[model samples]
Target chain A: MSRTTVVAALAAGVLLVAGCSSDEPAPAPSSSGGAATADAGQDHDYTVEGFASSVLGDGTLDDLEDVGSASGEIEGGQVEAQIVSVVADAAGTELVVVLRGDDTGSPSRWSESRGVFTDVRGVEVVDEAAGWRLQPYTILDVSGESDLGCACSEFPYRLGEDGTVVQALLPPLTEGTTSVTVALPGLEPVPGVAVTWR
Target chain B: MQTRPRRTPRWPVALLAAAALTLPTAPAHAAAAPEPGSTVDVAGVDVPVHGTFSLRAAGNASRDLVRGAVHGVRRVEGGTAVYLSLGLPASASRSLPLSSIFTRSRDYESSALAAVTLVDRPGMTAYVPLRGGDAAPYSSDVSEFRALKPGELVVLWAVFPELPAGTRTVDVLVGDARAAVTGVPVEDGALEPVADDLVPQAGEGWPKIAEGDALAGAEAPWSVRPLVQHRGSVDEVTDVAETAEEVDATLAADVLFDKSSATLTAASQDAIARLAADIAARGTGEVRVVGHTDSDGSDSSNQTLSEQRAAAVVAALQPASGTAVTFVAEGRGESEPVAPNTSPENMQLNRRVTVSYQVQEATR
Candidate 1:
């Protein structure tokens, strides 16, 4: 376990024992179902392995709702971007993570394959420090389409808690720039959840 | 002590009577309220799970005090709910699963208490930790208590905050535990309007009002004022409010009928009814009923037929009680047909009425 996980576990254990008497009867098993797998320090990449359900600590991630965006190209089709926002529900138990990004391309073409397609699936965080804050990372990773005998034709991917990431894979673009927005509804209950960029 | 007054002796009798009533009225035993700052341990986490719940006062605008223990918290995105549990044998900690229940009352504020219970058996007697307090109305309180049952797991409920009407964004939090933030677009009860005043007639395209293009084209004889666009059509321009030039209320219908047939078919009537109702409710723009026919018929015959048809429709629409009805009957025999008479389908297209809309003369 990383230092953060160890610290969180110790802190949680101490708080739990503080209020109870030493001789109090041991707590019975709870009827509520199962425990979540620990998600400490696990930054989600658009890769298939990064999309599993994991437990998040308190104050780690911020809840995001109703994410949407429009695509814009800058830096000669090398960089792309989208803007997003969400509402706040105090009783929520998880943070909603949304991703929307586009690849740079020609202005006249309406299709995305004719240009680079930078999306939330193409960018991934490589390394980070102990307290790296997370911004909305629209683009997750980027891959060159030239390897597949297709110029500018590339697929973009994103992560969803609903296990829809695999089924909802994006296809290679046709031309210009393509914008993809991942909207996750519902509540998030974690604390201090952050995203890192490589 | 010494007897000071003889008149005070009457007070002793009154005290005896009051004691008799007050003694019986008191509760058998007052239940003590739980102390503040309690903690619940579950899975590898400690939750400060106790707090006072209450609704605010009235006259300060809102009411509906909601307070109570609800079902457990579930990760909607991840599809998991957590229940806190502690074991006596220090090394044997386990995570419990739980669901959620939500409740609210009409009043803006009220108080409720919830207890967390851990059972030895799935459905047997369990350990319960109770917390009680007042809550605001319409607020949903979720927690980890459930109706007792053999197979039932953990349950929790929460008094969630208010949501806005249309697509809304909200962050769901537990004290400070952010379960998740989702951008949910609350569905407004309002019916979204489909494209309106669509003039689909051939020959005359929609008019060009400023930077926007209407159904004024060479193919469609009748012009349409596009209201709302769904999935984006050719003539529909989003955000046309700023640059589009407004046009005068001319003939606004998707169709023009043949002379003197007051018979509006079932298909044609549906479109006309929608247009008529839209105009009547929106503004003072009245429907102008014009009738035309193919050159196969005589002038006098066509003229009368056109007049009869226009009148029939005007009668059909009996505009909302006070709406003005404008029926103009002009017969142009075979003058304009949307499509060429080469195919039967093209001929049928010409044998119809056009519907369109313009700003009500009064509103502009």
Candidate 2:
């Protein structure tokens, strides 16, 4: 068989396995079912070769409120973002979100190009009276270190699905422990997620 | 402690005699209360260069201050010569070491500890004391390294060449401190006084004026005068003083060059000349000329056209001789338009050229 055909066949086989091993629960079906299919397909295992391993540090995980996962399809593949934790520090409180993407159609493309958090837009957290748009922290280097004389990285991250994971640092939040709604484009709002600080 | 001799091999006593004849004596004006703006610190002492007039004068002033309540300044052949006077406070007991006062770097041509430079100018030029001849019009004493005792002033001098014409005010930078000198009038090959009150008053501190506040309190009468009207259909020049890295000038391409052509029109020539003059009057460094185009043409064609236009501007800015300024050209084509190409006016805004120069303050 031709090289192009061989590559395509291999990509399909990998996607089939990834799609089956997804831990995400099957999304509820709707009359249109378009959004459901897109969300279901995006929940596949994105832990590919070049992805970041963990977004949370050893002890920082205890400070976060797990708000569950949200998914959407983008230009080259599917994107999944999970609002895992929130931590308050001297600078401000931040949302620690883990982001992953699956692109079985072209696994080699992911090998060449790593992920960037700027691709995700319109993600926000809303309280009953006010809403704060989440902006990606962008001052970190490749090793996740902030060179701005700070002890830790202040910027967000973009991770590939090759067994890699990244902790995306969202903008600062002023409200204390409260129920907030997390909204993503083309996905239902995950409401009543408690944002508690440690 | 040793008292160092002021004469050096590079300077001869015979040349000093000739200079004394031509050098203008210090003006007899009563020493006004030290203007807070003229003071700059050197080592641990306060140095103030006196006079409140603009340097944009027609004739060069023979004696000027170099801050620190001492050192003198004057117009020399190629550039300006500043006489550095190192002194100690009267309360001091023994002589203080020169090593503690000035930097001792291998980069300088002289063993002296301190160096002098213009504020915005780049490249580090060592301060060499007067080695005799017509160069040291004010003093024949060569600059040297020596310990200073209480109530004594040690004078050293250095010369800076090729300052642009019509330069009215400039900050004389030494070590980490800078003293602002105003009214050292420019001699444009002839002597004629041009009245200018836009001179900035130095505040009572080192590096007198703060960044982004060059014109903050310049509410003098000259600033409010109406701008001289130009004679063409040319668009007004827009100057935006962004950060130190970005250029402060924006020129509309439509006013400078014909459509689809890189050649400058008569009106454009006038604009470019004024720009070149301004660059010279200020400091010198690397100049970036970037060109942009409207989205009407193909991407590749537009890129090539933009590049050509930027090169044309670089060619026009080349100095006649002995200038440190360098020019570079770049083109962004239709990709980085400042405005949408929906209307004629919007497209006109996109078709323009920007000029910026680098500032080398750290080296000074």
Candidate 3:
């Protein structure tokens, strides 16, 4: 076969597979799409369109996967937090949470003292049943793909496609604690997000 | 609507050319001149270096003028210590304030001297000479603001931990004064002199032999407090605050734009150029330019102004060639402040722009 014929056939095969992948979620559309198609008289909630799928969950410290999610809001923008990963080391167990801000342009703010992450008032994991309130411990050590190109902060975090992913290192969950909660100061508390390892 | 012509398959030919291009190009060596002002000639002594601070001419009377020269660099335990001989020329007829040279408190972020970055790493810990040992100063103390008399040369040391091995040279910046110095061979953790001809003249009150004696010990007498540590390998060049995830940088808005205007000043453009180079060197990434303002203006006005300013910075920061990096502009107005806006100094701190980068790790 001619080279062009082979190239065309391969391209067609790839497109066929992409079109047939119904199980996979489609990529989010660009925010600029609405602006290009809008009429002068029409009003649009850019916030909702831009950031409605806001979700946050826990995952391993070294990976980005949805373990659980929590309700979060900043200003008028709704936030979703997913636990990206949980990493266990000599120090403690680190719960990596990915915080997404839909509609809020560049959700996280930068501080010289505090690295880049959202400027929410407070973030903590609560075990109300055990009467234990765990503060988020910032990860001082960063390397390889986990390093944020700026100065190192206590928390290991990276800016995502729609928001920020932060890691909180806390003491290992003790026995007898049935559930743990994740809290953002202004948003509604998300309870029972912790998973049972046993 | 226009119909596009079908393209021919050119990948076979391109792939062959790419394979040929990937052949070993050249060994890594220090570029003879990587900076515009790479050479400094003071008192007829020529030293090959790079910096923004000019040793060629006297600085303006209003600003404290500082000049630096790298004497030697040696590997110490846990870090690399760079011995710098700084001078405030007496001929300038003005005393250079010490506050501009080094901070007295541990809070390096607020120090004017914080601008001096160790180019090899993200951030550097600065030390000043004291009796029997070195003291790491912070920005919080007022007593640190001693003046530098003319013709007086003070030797200071900056230590950076875990510098990538095989790093033969590194750049040091003190305010605008920048120097790229070659590392000297170390014997017993002490720097051994290279060729005698390579040594630059140590000006009056600064004996060349005495300079090496100041840093003779294997360890500094006082415990060295590292402001920024390199947890990664030396090959990685990132911001002092940067980790594997992101890079954050703050540009004072007052230094960049005119009051209420989105236009960039010449100095701000230069600063942005440097920032762009740093971002580009990271290989590939996305840069989000965020604009912030103090609580002086109305909410709506502040928001609009902040957005416009951010857009202006983004425009300047974009690479001239391929789109390996994406730029996003955002404005927070008066919503976020690093400091309280009540005081003038604090308000000055509030008016700023932040550049954050989400870098993609290079597949090695």
Instruction: Give the chain B TM-score for each candidate.
Output: 0.28, 0.35, 0.36
| DockQ for all models | 0.01, 0.01, 0.01
For residues B1-364, write the lDDT of model 3, one tens digit per residue. 1111112334532332232223222111111111222222222222222222222111121333344455444455444554445555334467666554443334232322332333332122222222222332211122433565554444444443434554444334343212122122221232322224222223211222222334343243232222222211111111123434566767878878888999998867656776787677673666888999999979999999999999998888886413678888999999999878978988987888888876555521
Model 2 ranges with Cα > 4 A deviation? A1-198, B1-235, B244-246, B320-322, B360-364
Q: Give, for candidate 1 chain A, the lowest lDDT window spanning 10 residues.
A: A44-53
Q: Which stretches of candidate 3 lie over 4 Å from their true place?
A: A1-198, B1-52, B55-64, B107-116, B121-147, B152-154, B166-169, B175-243, B247-364
Give the candidates in order of TM-score, highest first: 3, 2, 1
Tens digit of lDDT per residue, candidate 2, span A51-94? 00010011111223347777665445666666764543223334
Computed on C-alpha atoms, the DockQ of candidate 1 is 0.01
Instruction: Report lDDT (Cα) of residue A19, candidate 3.
Output: 42
RMSD of 1: 28.8
Question: What digit string (tens of lDDT, one per residue) describes model 3 on residues A1-198?
Answer: 343343234333333334453433222122221110111112211111111111100101122467577654444555566765443322223444555544323423223324244322145556454344544322231223232122111221223334333443344455555456665455576776654442
Indicate which candidate wins on TM-score: 3
Supply the TM-score of chain A against the true chain A for every candidate structure. Answer: 0.21, 0.40, 0.45
- The true-structure Cα RMSD of candidate 2 reads 31.1
For model 1, the docking class works out as: incorrect
